[model samples]
Target: MSARHIILCINVGSSSCKFALYSVSGGAESIVAEGVADRIGSSGGKIRVRDANGRSIAESDRDLARPQVAVDALFDEFERLKLPRLDVVGHRIVHGGAHHVAPEIVTPALIADLKRLIAFAPLHMPGGIEGVEAVAARHPKLPQVACFDTAFHRGMPERAERFPLPRELWDAGVRRYGFHGISYEYIMQALGADVPTRLIIAHLGNGASMAAVENGRPLDTTMGFTPAGGFMMGTRPGDLDPGVILYLLEQKGYDAAQLSRLVNLKSGLLGVSGLSSDVKTLLDARGSNANAAMAVEMFCYQIKKAIGALAAALGGLDMLVFTGGIGEHAAAVRAEACQGLAHLGLAIDPRRNDSNQDTISAADSRCRVRVIPTNENLMVARHAARLVFPAG
Candidate 1:
């Protein structure tokens, strides 16, 4: 057996593709290189490939009409690098439906099944499928593994996973399928035994969600069945009452396509503030702009409510972890979310929270609040390595 194995972790978004290469020796893995192809299929499409030390390896901006075009460009860079014999390609797939509760080697049949799931999460699945297909076409001989974002929540109890819809709908597989499981998995791995039994992890980013984890298993999550349903995000509304959708369709003159665009693209922070969807921009403007203040308030309010709900789900909260972009860096948001949750025994140490620390909980707080930077790609690489070589 070879001493070194290369694992390529691919995370494809709606108009972007991020990949990281890792080298595994024995049981340890190290990041070899990583970068992203963004604004895909547009005239302004650009890509940047960087080494592990944050130095640029390759960069480009060229007109394109599809993500595959950008992906093909990536393949060109790979050939130039000629890194090593690739052992496995691990893909980040958003939804696995009721099937695919674990990592599985890619096959045509598996691809077909995943394609059928596109309607469930139309915004995300297509890009992931496109990335997987591109890899299949470019390097058909190499073994590929798919790591699911929903697979981590596979152990959720029947009640938690079931929607209140009719029994027929349940039989037809219409139930809650929480997303962002890979990131959550990484947090659990990063926390290990130090992370108390009952935990609540808030993954705040462009697409945000909160999870109730008891003994390292998911009991419930804020985002149910789709990425758009969760805490308000950069551009996506968190949970909306079913009546809102009905009213929009009947009285607000909204077609399915229009509603999709509004809910998934034009809403959230942008809609709330009537400004940019970026958190940094909102944070800067919140003090002076009423709309920005409201947006920030709404975002924190939703997160606080979710934390309370998850605390109830876990019977009690022990460890509260913050990850992702806003969760890791946005101290104000974290502070705001924990403001009214003191009754739940959660409090953030202002100094530790402001500074970059592993645990941000105050000494007197009953719950251990943490700030853990998640590594979804590393989680994918580790899962892929184990799947490809169960015993090494």
Candidate 2:
């Protein structure tokens, strides 16, 4: 057995690839180096790698046409930097379908199973599979683990996970599969025994979702079936009426691809604002447009409604956790979501909220409002280490 082990955690997105290296010590893992490769395909930019302290160690510009070549360059960087052997590679797969309800060692069968879920997460799974395939080709013997973003919600009750549809659709597997499991799992792990019996965690980022977790297990989530199915996202429409899709198909003669593009790209904050999808920019505006303000208002309203629904699912809410980029930093958005939740005894102290404190809840608030940074990389590394170094 190796005395020292290194784990590489990879999260591959449509046009970006984020990598993190971790080392185990004192029965806990710590990140050593992490970076991202953005704009992988066309007009490729720089590859940035930095140490734990944010010290730049290696960086160079390159042009590429695909993720496979980009991932290959990452391996070359490892050699140039004299990085140690990677004991295991943990990948962030977007969809695992019904088969992978937990992390699994990467095998040919598992790969095939994951491939079948590509259509379910068209924009994400392809890049993720490309990264996995690239790594497998370069390092065949290295143990690899596939950690799913949907697996944490595997335990959702039939009622909560099921979509109200015909029996045939249900039988055909047309149901909700919540994502951002890695982040949700990290929050639960952070809570430990302190985790309340009923909890609602809001993961607000470019692609956002809220999960109803009871006793540290996922009971329901905001994003259902697909990433585009959740609350309004930076660029993706969420929870549109079925009639809208029908209108697009029948009236506009739009196909699946065109509809997908509309819902995933030309919608959300950008669509509403006709400005930018970024929340920070909207917040900084001197004068507000009706559409932008309406978009922001609608966004918060949707989140509040989701929280209420999840609270109902959990019977009651005890812990309300906020994670991800927007969740952690968007004080105004958080306040708006908790506005009418005073009935649930959820109140945020204006001063604390503005300071971006972890605990923003008022002293008398019943619910504990905490802002926890999502460490998906560390979570993936831990899961990979458990599989690669499992004790007999």
Candidate 3:
């Protein structure tokens, strides 16, 4: 098939469904169109579609009170535009446990298995499954692929993947299944022949994690059994002290839902700043509250510490990559991360860093630095297409 054939990649979240239309030809994928439907199941929802350059092609503010309804409306927009039928549909599933090491052709058995894994990532898995079902309903015979966020971390050594708990828990699949594999995989492909032997990829966004990638495979990562365990995120507690949980139960009489809400909703930068969960907001009003400034500082500190820890895991470091929302856009965060890494020869050219260039490393720097914008959607599409037509 020609590359002009489009692929629809869906990233269904609790509050939104992000869809991207891509044309994959000549081993490269280009965004043909993209859209996001926000506030699904809520009042005042909107859907905005844009072309490759992010120019809005169409937008609507109708009542999309359910995920299925929103997806139908989106397909209607594509039909109105006289777009070609999708060659494949890629869905991002948050966890795959040990079964799915890479993207797989979505079958009845696979869907059942994915449904079983829903307890692993309760907040993310349901919405993802909803998108998959919606797509399957719309195009019953269309090829579908499931790209796992934990698939890349299957590269982790048995030791790194294991927990300190009993073998019973380990056998029951209670171990680390690092999230954000698609992001790390995209970075690895971007590195191409320049792929580093020992590296750490920081995917900093609302939901963040750091993966210690060696030779383009995950060796160890910060995120644990769930996405809620990694480095501090916009609203997550990250690595929490076990004793704090005991205290919350004993002192505050907190239930599972209450604790989940506290850690996943009211923590991280928002908890520290007593302000917004967004980095841009914190940066804007950093002067207003010392707490806000401190929140950003602490965020950077945790990231730097994770980098150092990953370096230690690899015995040394050759490169460090920053991706995702905060990682690509925040120049100050990048500079601050490389500040004390002189010992490892990680130096950034001030001009390059300030300009938000991809290659921000100094010419003579010992360790390389790159700011690769992640394209999980494209990666998902490739995975799905590969599964559907293995020898294409």
Which number leads on TM-score?
Answer: 1
State residue 92's C-alpha deviation in candidate 2, in Å.
0.3
For candidate 1, the per-residue lDDT at 228 reads 85
Clash pairs detected, candidate 2: none
Count the clashes in each prediction. 0, 0, 0
Mind sharing the TM-score for model 1?
Answer: 0.97
Q: Rank the candidates by lDDT, best first.
A: 1, 3, 2
Q: For model 3, how does the per-residue alpha-carbon lDDT over 1-392 read when each residue is reduced to its tens digit?
A: 55455789999888798999988775567889998998988998898999889899898897878778778878888999877688888888899988799888888899899899988888888888888888889999988888999999998999999988999999889999999999888888888998879888889899899998776767899999999897888999898888999999999899999998998899999999999899989988888889999999998888888888889998899988899999999888788877898887788999999898988999999888988999899888888767776564
Task: Score candidate 3 by lDDT.
Answer: 0.88
- Over 4 Å off in model 2, which ranges? none
Best by lDDT: 1
* Weakest lDDT window of 10 consecutive positions for candidate 2: 282-291
lDDT of each: 0.89, 0.87, 0.88
Clashing pairs in 1: none
Candidate 1 C-alpha lDDT tens digits along 58-145? 8888654676776788778877877666778999999999888998999999999999999888988998988889888888898899
Residue 231 lDDT, candidate 2, scale 0-100: 85
Segments in model 1 whose C-alpha atoms lie over 4 Å from true places: none
Task: Estimate, for each residue in 55-113, the C-alpha lDDT of model 2 and write its tens digit.
Answer: 99998987756778778888888889988788899999999887688888999988887
